[model samples]
Target: MLRVKVAKEIREKEQLGDELKTLRSKVKELEKSLSGLKDEHARLAENEEKFRTLIENSTDLKYRCDLKGRISYLSKAWEDALGYKSTEMIGSKFSDFQSPESIKFDADEFLKELIDKKISSYEAAYISKSGNIIHLRFNVMLYRSHTGSERGIMGTAYDITGLKCIEDQLKQSQKMEAVGRLAGGIAHDFNNLLTAIIGYSEMLMMNNLLPENAFQSADEINKAAHRAAALTQQLLAYSRKQVSRPRAFNLNKLVNNLDMLLRRVIGENIEFFTVLEIDVGLVIADPGQIEHVIMNLAANARDSMPNGGALTFETRNVNLDEEDCEKYPEVTPGPYVRLTVKDTGHGMDKETARHIMDPIFSIMDPIFSIKEGGRRTGLGLATAYGIVKQNNGQLRVTSEVHQGTAIEIYLPRAEEKIEKKETPQRKLETEGGNETVLVVEDESAVRIMVGTLLKGFGYSVIEAKDGNEALEFCRQNKEMMIHLLITDIIMPDVSGFDLVKRVIKTHPGTKVLYISGYSEEEISNKGTLGKKVPFLKKPFTPTVLARKVRGVLDRD
Candidate 1:
């Protein structure tokens, strides 16, 4: 019995040892599992903090919305972007922040599509706290629940207002460029026709043998033709195709010269003020074009203030540095002369101001003006805009509704001293010269008229119908002392430039004078005129022709 008890005790001890070892192994496994759970929790906490930092620090507007389109969470960027705090926007519907025209797609429909498509992007305009519209491009993704059902949307919005403005400006510029090309072509043809009409009319007026009544009729025709010529010049100006005869001149002086004329145009009701800067720098630009700019602006100001108001013209010298270049991208960093025109009349709103430079968008487009007995072509401002730009200058306008309008033009300063031009009171001599001259023109009327005029002016005249005839004449009369050659720039058989080149070889001492109805740009190159050759514009009176011929012939 003693042996049995001892054996039983040993067996129980062995079983207890096995059970204890098993429990110890299980405890070790549990410890390893606990350690892994703690590490995983710590990793998840770190990931959450990183995501929060990214959302909070992002420049773009980040937001979360429920499937119902209600805002649940919004980043602090909402305050910076729309002037609305996150707290103020948390419970608001997304549509509440959008303009009526900007809600292109329904919120519910957008969410449905987002859920069905998994992700989407689009553009919309949001209304800011100040009531200004903000353009935004959105990038969004639909968030899903654990059960694979749609939970909400996570999205970011980027501001695109500046880019939108630039795009609008580019589109408008392209439209104007197309119109300019068309206008230039039409003006070239019209100018040729006007030259013949005006020249012949003047000839009739000069003929003393004509009836007394004929003088008045011819004068009327000439006056009307002059007005038409002015219109053509305006077209050329707007198209940027006008040949600029740039010279150094004082802008303040130009303004001062126009003082009497500007006052008369503005009428008795309006008050005029001039603010000229002492020692204002001279600007390099076409004097005629600059005068037109001032006149156009003055006329516009007059129309704006029909009920009577103050019109101010001011000038000053300014130096634009790199900072100015950034502020005014159309201007360079250099010395500039600024001319400002300000009026205390009705001002334009943003929408109207945007299209102020468009030729057809005038207040006169409706066949009437907002004021009594007012009519305008709306091309005045546009011509000024083109002239300023072509001269490497900048024109800027600002206006507010019922407040007033202001226009600023900045032109580059010139290095040379300026000499103001004045018309001489002495009458130009119209006496005929005895020098032998050759006239070439494609138009029969123009050719005959010019030949008759020169003959009347006492010059022995020879006429040619075209370039071929002119070239043949020059070759045949190689020994003839052709004192001067006056020819039209464009001809059928040969260009005037080529004809001149060949003729000069035979008659080396013959002085050449080019006549043209074409704009300087049209006849500048492409086998047209030589750089140093003297030119006479068509539609000129007999007096102008005689003086030009004498001037060229007398040149040493």
Candidate 2:
């Protein structure tokens, strides 16, 4: 019995040892698992350090601030860009660098957004440590602790000062372009009215209706009307609506002849200098337009100098090679006659110089502090630009504030020697035949004036208010022989061009004369008749209208 009891005790001890060994194995497994976890943690820590280094050294400005708007930290980029040490700005309020005008409202709005939106972004200007204004696009988010409690605000800001400046310049340029187009349109119509008035006045003066005293009054009216007409022509030139009769002409002769007039116009206070190069090559341009361009430029120079200064007009021969064409895409490679107008006056700033050729730029002189009286209508330079462009020329300007301004016009030399066309003698006056003529116009005054003028010329006249009426009249007169058709370019129902086409189709032998206040190019584009058809520009004098009608009717 004693031996059996001792064996039981030994068995119990063996069982106890087995349980202890199993417990040790379990402990060893747990230790291995912990070691693996520690290794992974270390790897993660290294990756986190790399990420922090990248953020701290990134070119983009990275920053963090407390919920109360006090800056906690800023990346090295901010310090490098804005000339600020990160340590010096770390404890400062974010509003400290903001513009005072926008600070309170902007700060309040931003703080509210941070609390409500979790993320907010904006573009704003900030004052740097160097007192320079820097534009920045800021993207910020509210940071939260692991427990979901708000900690601080963090953001990245990108410098955008250069981009902002370019955007502003673009906006100004667009505005100037729009205003130039508007001014050009208005000037075109105004020119037509002035043309009619001046032409009629000249015809009336030839009538010999009054004594010398009355003649002076008529002369004054004529002078004033002519002056106004000249102004309107300038406007038309600016609008690119002016009819340019380009011919090869000697630039030297033109400038020399106009020198005296230019000097007189600029007045004695301002000194005028002409650097006319001897024997400059002939240029293909309208002489009247070139004259107007010179006059307008001289006037502008005069105004620039309230306290008299030197104005120089220089002419030279230049060969525009491939390099010049590359630099100025608008110019072609050829021999060119360069006309430069320089002025020693209060020079224009970059902004003003950029818009000098804009029709409405002069209007803003007061606001921009470029000029005081603002008496000079900015149309002068715009007209010069348009005329130069129409003549296949290039205009370039250089100006420095307080130094001076220089404008250069490069006109291509005439390629071919233009033959002079002799002017035909005026036709002998003749009583009109008994043939009927159709006159179509939209404006009643213009229509009546035309009818009266046609009657004075002794042609039997039939008038229509519009194209539809004109068409009806032609249909009704299918049997009657209509000698000539005088019609306005623009009308309701059917345009003059369409009516002409329809009439020509029905009455193949019918003759048509187109009239318009618009440029001849504009009238021809109506598809009326081919370029072979003649166009009479409005507003025509009674005699001029009579002559045109008679000429068309008598054409072979």
**Cα lDDT, all candidates:** 0.82, 0.76
Kindly report the root-mean-square deviation of model 1 from the true structure over all alpha carbons: 4.4
Q: Write the per-residue lDDT of candidate 1 for residues 447-470, one digit (tens) a residue.
A: 788888888778999999888998
Stretches of candidate 2 above 4 Å error? 1-105, 125-135, 142-192, 211-214, 237-262, 271-294, 312-342, 348-361, 364-436, 520-530, 540-555
RMSD of 2: 7.7
TM-score top scorer? 1
User: What would the TM-score be for candidate 2 when compared with the true structure?
Assistant: 0.66
- Candidate 1 displacement at residue 382 in angstroms: 0.4
Worst 10 residues of 1 by lDDT: 363-372
Q: Write the per-residue lDDT of candidate 2 for residues 172-200, one digit (tens) a residue.
A: 54664566467556655664565456555
